[model samples]
Target: MSTSATEPEAADLVCQLDNVQGMVDALTSVRWKRHQDAVVELSEHGIVLIVEESRCLQAKVYLQRELFVRYGYSAQGRPRFGVSLGLFVDCLNTFSVPGHSSTIEIQYPGPDMQLLLKSLDSANACIYAEIRTRIPDMVSWDYNFEPAGSTPLSFTVKSSALKEAIDDLEWPGSSIQITLQPVPPSVTFRGDGHGNLQIDFKYYVNTDLLVAFHCDHQVSYRYKYKFLHATTSNIPASVIKDNRGSKLTIGRGGMLKVQHLVSVARPSISHSHVDSAGYQQPSRIAYIEFFVKPEEDEATGNDS
Candidate 1:
């Protein structure tokens, strides 16, 4: 087949990242349900991977353009495609090697495009895999969470503290209640089941636990513990070590939003470059966010 000069090539649309495992880990951190497929949207800014569960919750893993050493897209408009999340994660996992650093390159040609992944490690080891792609579904969950506009009761808590509190609680509960007020016990968690358990969050004199707390009116809402526990249960160890906190917001009618800032790429000397002063520049800081929605229930009508 003959190709024209103005035509786009199969390798024209490509994105290369220095740390493939970092991106993989971020996506897998929020992988609670095994959906058959996921949607990948490509644009000038970056790439976004969307995963949903039973139409109740949605998680997005974003890899911004700055995270990539090289990112290119020749399409006139944004391009989106769907691929098997399981297969995709498996392909990335094939390149996993202990004590080795790897880079990944992804290429998308055109219609009937196949997703290609190439990984190269410091040990000169190379791994490549190609998976098929399909047109994404027309229906997708919209995650337009605007806390500024909405009158939501929001607060921030250290991820480690929250994880520990949830772990210590007795499980097998049907629902979990979150109560926020403008007084002491600013935040409260109640698990209703065979045994009642309550974990309260208040300003301590010697500790910096709650970073921020804001509430207009005292509100209490119940959510499926299973759904709310997904994020806390599967928290990445690195997130806990880094002490990255999570911002939780509860809107009217029991809508819950959990947001986390995950460090995707760590600053390293190898990734740095020499500056004019002959000193190595610091590596770039890259991060991705995880958004989780909990299945909300009717108000419990309890103020205290």
Candidate 2:
């Protein structure tokens, strides 16, 4: 089996995850298609799964070491390989029971260099799967987002509300325009097609809905509706249930960056540690990021 030049051939990696469904949900967020391939990079910090589409859209899911119950890494360097994303997600789904939470043990680079996963909850009916892996192709996009000028064009909104607005704007428009201005401190989503539709979130009027708004100058950019929807289409239920907020930022050259946090802690259980004063820490969360390129056209009307 071929491996990255920085990594040794015979290294070993094993980890135990208490929240099987959490892993499933996190991975599913990036599974855009039924048979997409993802690049898996394992480091001392944790595992990173990357999936991209047509070089225009890319997403990453960071499974940090702290999220795992036990993370064992003895590799000389970071190891990266390619695996079938659909197969991996399907295999992990088998370990997730509706009402019963189970633990799963994950190991990498089996004798034949296959990803290994097994359910640890049931001894009699243990579920085990071995998926084939291959040498990963070079990732197409690694954009360094330019700063959004001095004001930092950004906003934070409830994930559920953001998802709803994006879904409702899925009409006949091929591109969606996003505008942010500091005058009234608001963000607008506009879809122009046979039937024009617009949704606005005024910071002062709906403080709770539009939690944070920062825009020094008026900036607007158009993006493919499909790409915009992908960022919120597969948002995990856990994110909505926790009432988490999604952050959106527009960098230089109209690059759009969307960030979401998915908790990996077991459900109905506390994964925090208390200090002497009985102050509890926050649950371990997985970080997800998406980068979407803007359309070729310049900003439309009302762009300062």
Task: Write candidate 1's Cα lDDT for 51-125 as tens digits.
Answer: 766676666677778778888776667778888887788778777665555677777753347777667454566
Residue runs of model 2 more than 4 Å from their true location after superposition: 1-11, 269-283, 298-303
**CA RMSD of each candidate after superposition:** 5.4, 4.6
Report every candidate's CA lDDT: 0.67, 0.83
lDDT of 2 by residue, 160-243 (tens): 899999999998598899999888888999999978999999999988788788888998899999999999988898877665
Q: Which one wins on lDDT? A: 2
**What's model 2's lDDT at 289?**
90
- Candidate 1 regions off by >4 Å? 1-12, 109-111, 121-124, 148-152, 169-172, 205-207, 266-297, 301-304
Relative to the true structure, candidate 2 reaches a TM of 0.90
State TM-scores per candidate.
Answer: 0.81, 0.90
